[model samples]
Target: MSHHRSPPSPPPPEPPESPSSVYCTPSPQSKATTPSPTARFFLSRHQSFIKPSPLTKHILPRQQSSNTLPPEFPYEHDTAKTSVGLYLRKHRRTNPAIWCSAIICLIFSILFIFIVVAILIIFLVVKPKTPVLDTSHATLNVIYFDSPGYFNGDFTFIANFSNPNKKLNVRFEHAVMQLYFEDGLIATQSIQPFSQRRKETGVVVIRFVSSLVSMSSNHARELQKQVMSNKVFYSVRGTFKVRASLGAIHFSYWLHGQCELQMSSPPSGSLMARTCKTKR
Candidate 1:
């Protein structure tokens, strides 16, 4: 009833194409011209592995150069530091005691020079003077000769000690007198110690008596001749140790004196003529 007559017979199946058809066969020209994706990928990966990185190329030369060179000293960097190092090395070789002793000796030398200069200046400014001494008078009291070689005589003498300095005082430490008959020493005497002010003179008195002295034959004859001639010759020598003081400054000296006497007296207590000389 539906009348649908069987659907129109299904369409007939299409026929298989032949191997030589354009749609069924691959083109050899296209296959030979273009590379495969797998091959292209492999080549790109090989190139990436072989090439060096930019960072590595820059750093490698610096490392190699640093490793090859010798190590450098640190002190060569600054001139000031090098000089300081050298200075320290020099001082390290010297002993500290040596430096200290050198400084002390230099100081003492300066001080000694200063003291000497000061003393010289003081001497120039002071204008100091030396003292003087002299014999003032001499007298022959008596003269007598008994027997062949026995002689007796008496004499008196006076000495004058004077201080010439205007600002100094003098002290006589010792005074000695010797009576000489030609080259023979007959008698010696000492005087008392005394002090004299500046520009002052002190007097010393002495008396001597000769004992019965034995004389040589020649001396006795000479003396007799002198007595007959009414003249006698004698010598007096003296030594004095004196110290001069002015404030804190003090000086000492030895004084010597020689005096000659010629007396025209016989058994009298008076002098005829005398002469004196002194040295300091």
Candidate 2:
């Protein structure tokens, strides 16, 4: 039988969209596939604002670290690089001042040593000599006896100081002269300071008077016997402070001398018959 099937009822019309479905479902795509300029700018901004998570040091790959550093770099790591930089900076600040002071001290020491060596060499080569001293005979200017045992006399003497060094100068500060008769002080004389040129001679004249000098009884008797026999004896002691100089170098010396005099007759006129013995 050709039964006319009623047309399948049209599918039920879709229900109006619910509020929950509208929020959960995706929007329909536009026919244009490429994103717009505004959308691209917004995506780039979002990516830039997002922060990356930290990398764990223990899990870092060795190859990645090696690739990041240049092969010719001296330090192995950041910490080592920082330490070397700090050491270099500190040394640069302090080393110059220290080195300057050390160099100055070394130079001064060398100069002082050189000066001392030069002085020693000059002294060895020079070989300077001390001055020479000579004494002439003394003459009696006046002689008198106030009492039997009291004897007095005025005597004149000459001293010759000669510098033997050809290139050295000599200075005599002072001279102390003492006259003795049988170990008793009879007179004393002092001379002023003077300077002598190289290989030059200086003359000093001294006059001393003995006043109220008493002799021992034995001495008086001996003196009387000597007077009758025309023989008399006297002693003189002298000390001189002298300085010898050769250029800048100078040295001091004490010149000591002892002399004995013998007179065979009383001194008269301009000359005296006397003999003198002297020692340096």
Best by lDDT: 1
lDDT of 1 by residue, 1-280 (tens): 5665666788899887687864545589978987799988998999889977888788677745553323364445465567779988884468899999999999999999987875575468755455555565677766677777777777887877777777778888998888777655656789888999988987888777777777777887876687788787878888988887767767678888877777666665344566776678
Roughly what TM-score does model 1 have, to 2 decimal places?
0.56
lDDT of 2 by residue, 165-221 (tens): 777788888779887777877799988889998989878887878888887777777
Q: What lDDT would candidate 2 get against the real structure?
A: 0.73
lDDT of each: 0.74, 0.73
In model 2, where is the ten-residue run with the lowest total lDDT?
A: 269-278
Candidate whose TM-score is highest: 1
lDDT of 1: 0.74
| Candidate no. 2 TM-score | 0.52
